[model samples]
Target: MKSEKSKNGLYSHFRLKSSMSFLMALLVFVFSCSESDDGQMQGPEPVMPPETSMAPDMSMFDDEGGEENRVNTIQNWAYAAINVGVYSSILYSHLIVPVRAFKVTINQEAHFNEDAGLWVWEKSFEVPSRGTFSVRLTAEVDGTDVSWTGYVSKSGVFENFVWFDGTSKLNGESGKWNLYESPENPEAWLSNSWEIDREVGNGNTSFTVEKEGNHQGSSITYSIEKGADYDRTVLINDVSNSNLVEVQWNKESKFGRVKSEAKYGDEMYHCWDEQLQDSECP
Candidate 1:
């Protein structure tokens, strides 16, 4: 009987040990599975931000800037040709340089900021002396070549001295301004009433009939700084009562239509030079 009891106790101990070993193994497996699942849930690899490039150095472009570029890069006018001159007369020397009329390679693409608003037609020209000059510009406005003309009523570089004799006869007015042409040339005219407008440095000046109505006759006499003995001409014509009248330059003279430049650090009358860098004009 003692031998049988000892065998039963040994069997029981073996069975109990096997059950505890199995439970320990199962807990270890569960912990390992939980750790693996947590690692997978963390997500994909992180992405780094892109690096930025340094700013470029701009000193090279500054070296090429100069007055020549500013002067030559004048906004070319959009037209076949521009007509500029002073009226022909002895009072105003008849300096005639024919206006070369030609079209640019491209029309609308050529423009500059002289006025600093919308681009307007611009050109570069030179006169031999200083005097009163008139410019009659005919350009293609709205794709149509219409003559939109204006004049420089005063003197400018390469132009000096001016003597203009103009006459006007009003419908009801009495005596006219008896004007005479000086430096007498082939063309001359005598007038009763005349008006001349002059503009100095910053102040721009223009002239026209004061009141537009039934006027008898009107004339314009341009007096340049230099010219023949009496090279004066008159543009006398009768017109119906209207504010808008067709006027002409008494003579054809050379005019300088340079590109407009920035007017910095100055007033209109006392501002910068044509290029607007500094006062280069003497």
Candidate 2:
């Protein structure tokens, strides 16, 4: 028969083993729902079509206008048109940085966030001449609609800068991205927000720049149609003067035209040649 001291030692050993088993089971339970992709979720990151596919090519006019005397000075028509063109190009140029940050995840790996039950693609890196940035893209599927969000953070600058959030069909045929300007542009148009509606593979995209608060009714509509006659187009609506100024051009040849009801005093297209000098319409 065992002595009483030996019986107590046996009990202590049993209790220690039982406690360790319980701790191990608890750990397994906790990690069972941890973040890891194991073939039970959607595919890779939501498709982010290249920005160049829709970005307007207005650089053709970079070499035009601003000439005092070019033997082509009809009301400085080309100059007026170039002003509008410059504005159009600048509107979207600011967004390229953040947009590209989100696109970098296209070839990278993403893990399923089991806690959130969503596929998350996130990155933190430095962009040459753009400083450092962190971007997150979350995608969820509810029915045929794929809701995607692009959130960004700049080190020592800002966090949760929602660059864009929009939805698209599962097939990626059509969608719209609501784009917001970066904090770097402190003087951006007051309460300004941009919307881009695109039909992928169709070369169809529309842009709308809007302002809120005290600057109401100052919205502008612009577009770029690749195969159309006037491929580069910027339409500015002057609500105060009840005028419409349009700037259009071809990317390859830089041949373009402009017109404004208020300034021009008539409905006629002011033409410009390949050299961006004033030209008589044929």
Highest lDDT scorer: 2
lDDT (10s digit) by residue, model 2, range 1-282: 479889999999999999999999999766665424553444444555435323444555443434554335534345555455544554545566555765675666766676575667898877668788888877776666667777788877798777766676655555666666666642223122223345522243444444343323543444556677767666665555566777777767777788776766878888887766678765
Per-residue accuracy of model 1 over 83-170 as CA lDDT, tens digit each: 0111122112332221110111113233322222112233333446642343322222222112222112233332212222121222
Per-residue error for 88 in candidate 1, Å, reads 3.8
lDDT of 2: 0.60
TM-score of 2: 0.63
lDDT of each: 0.26, 0.60
